[model samples]
Target: MKQSAYEAAVGLLSRRDHGEKELRSKLLSKGFAFEEVTDALTRCKEYGYLDDSRYCELMLRNGINKGWGPQRIQQSLKQKGIADSRIQEMFLDLDIDWFEQARVTAQRKFGSQVQRTKDRQVEMKEKAKRFRFLQYRGFDFEQSNYALEQLSL
Candidate 1:
């Protein structure tokens, strides 16, 4: 699987844009030597063919649509080798009201069920469960609780 630098770079671009680290990792996995991969990665960066920030922005939108919170999104970007500073800048730049979004999402998922509860305790528990679900969906505890409360009202 010896791919010429141009071939590998083009192959990568043909699929989707990749962050430098991700692109390099893929090239290495494809058996490109370290120096070659580095050169390819540098070339990609120089030509503006790859951008971690753009990747973060795209992933952020996707994560939000899928009902994820900032912490979860940040953690994921970090795992992809994105810098913390850039992650912060992008998160802030996106200017998302995460709580409101999560609240809306929770309401959509469980609003009808709230009306069917037979007891306050049971309802509270159910709401808590919904909160936990949002947490798993990448929301923080505070955001989850706030979302549940908003929907409960």
Candidate 2:
């Protein structure tokens, strides 16, 4: 016997949290009827099994823990079918200090004090390297600069 959409959805949710949109997509791809998927989604939401906000929070926390900046985290959540508004709201809810996060990430990656070199070219190279790292980590200019400043990067 074929499993119902709700059963499939519940099974997926039991393994890990999934965003509403992601769950719907998965169910539809598995050949469940559109209506069945919709009904299953509604039921899941009603049962407090599927929640975009909750899923967003989990993703946000994961991103932060992994040292990702706001831009990167937002991009990831968007790819996972999370709404921009929802991502922003959850970011606000998290009350993260992005500048501080950058500093922490820098300290974690680089040492507490950057080694100074007698060569001006080497110092410039070191600064550029560290700045690029922060930028790639999704930090904005101001935030990156602040972290670099803190690290003497």
Candidate 3:
């Protein structure tokens, strides 16, 4: 027999936290009716089994552990269907220093050797490469430059 919407949602939550949109999509894909899905979601929220704020906090902590910057984390949260207002609120209260994160990420990746190059052109190229890498890692230019400076010192 097919599982009920509540059962399916509970089972999914047993494995890991899921955003409301993600859980709803999964339930719909499993052939649950729209009303049933909505009801299940509401019940879960009412019971404290589903919370976007908790999910956001977990994602933010995980991202920081993995050396991800705020930009990337925000983008990821948005993609996961988290509301912009919640995301902003979480960021506002977060104590993480993004520039320090950038520095640590750079140190972890390239070590303090970023300033060893003596040739001006080669140094420029190296700095450019580091900039691109940090940018790809979701750091802004100012943060990236600050990281490079820290490495030079």
TM-score of each: 0.88, 0.93, 0.94
Query: Can you write out model 1's per-residue Cα lDDT over 23-139, one digit (the tens) per residue?
Result: 778888888789988887777778877878788888788878877777788888888888889988897678778889888778778763357566888877776678778988788
lDDT by residue (tens digit), candidate 2, 52-90: 988998998898999989988999999999998888788
Give the range where candidate 2 is weakest over 10 consecutive residues by summed lDDT. Answer: 87-96
Clashing pairs in 3: none
lDDT: worst 10-residue window of model 3:
112-121
- 75-151 per-residue lDDT for model 3 (tens digits): 99999999999999999999978999999999999986644655788888888898899898889989999999999
How many steric clashes does model 3 contain? 0
Better of 2 and 3 by lDDT: 2
Query: What's the lDDT of the predicted structure labeled candidate 3?
Result: 0.91
Backbone-clash count (model 1): 0
The lDDT of model 2 is: 0.92
Q: Which prediction has the highest lDDT against the true structure? A: 2
